[model samples]
Target: MNQDKRQILAQYEKSMTWVESLADVTEEQWRTPIEVGKWSVAEVIGHLIPWDEFVVSKRIPLLFTEDSLPKAPNVQEMNANAANSSRLQSKEETIGKFLNGRHQLIDALHHLTDEQWQHSFHIGESELTLYRYFSGLVEHDWHHFLQIEKVLK
Candidate 1:
């Protein structure tokens, strides 16, 4: 793998470790909102599951294929549902789901050819390289990680 691809894979792998380390966090801390009116730590983690699942199932397969990509999910409904699920589930369950979805995504990404990393694909009308797309996701992850870290601190 190229350096960039290796970095992305390492980030994804590191995320599993980081989240697993959260197993020791207190229930109250996990449930507390990261900000005044934003998602709690659990909700933030839970929201990631569906997005990863979507990428593994919907995006990856069609990226270099002739088929048009599937339409994006209803963001509001999807996020609300995930947050609600986090609220109702135990911290262990939420983390487990997140790990599962992320594992599936990482496994799928690992199977892509090196050429696919630089290939452009259509998302509706916008075109983005696989590396650029995953890079954006990594940025999104870091944004939430910072929010959670701030609250935890």
Candidate 2:
């Protein structure tokens, strides 16, 4: 496999492995706040799923088209919406969404040819590669992941 594919697959595998590690967490543990004023583990996973869904259903497909890229969503609004909606959901449901969202995203990108993997999208003043875009997501995953780890420890 090429470098982009390797990185993409590696990131997906890393995320899935982390999910697997959460299989035995208790309900209270899942609901415990990571910090005094911070989100619970479920809430953090809640925040992630919508972006993954957007990438699978919208962003990746848009990247393949000639149309101009859309403006970014309001992150605060998005996070608020996710937290509000996910509060009604069980911890298992939130985790399942995270797993499903990542699976769908990785499966969608796996269909791309090497050329597509190298495809660049110009946004504002910068051009971004598919690799860089998705690698940032891997970092995003780790950002919330550390919260889960720190509090759970």
Model 2 CA deviation exceeding 4 Å by range: none
Candidate 2 per-residue lDDT over residues 1-153, each given as its tens digit = 568888887888788779767767888888787898888777887898888887787687788688877766888999988987667888778878888888888898788778887778876677899888888888888888988999889
> Against the hidden reference, what TM-scores do the models get?
0.96, 0.92
Best candidate per TM-score, number? 1
Candidate 1 on 58-120: residue-level lDDT in tens? 999989999988898999999999999999999999999989988998899889988888778
Off by over 4 Å in 1: none
As a TM-score, model 2 comes out at: 0.92
Candidate 2: clashing residue pairs, number: 0
Residue 124 C-alpha lDDT in model 1: 84
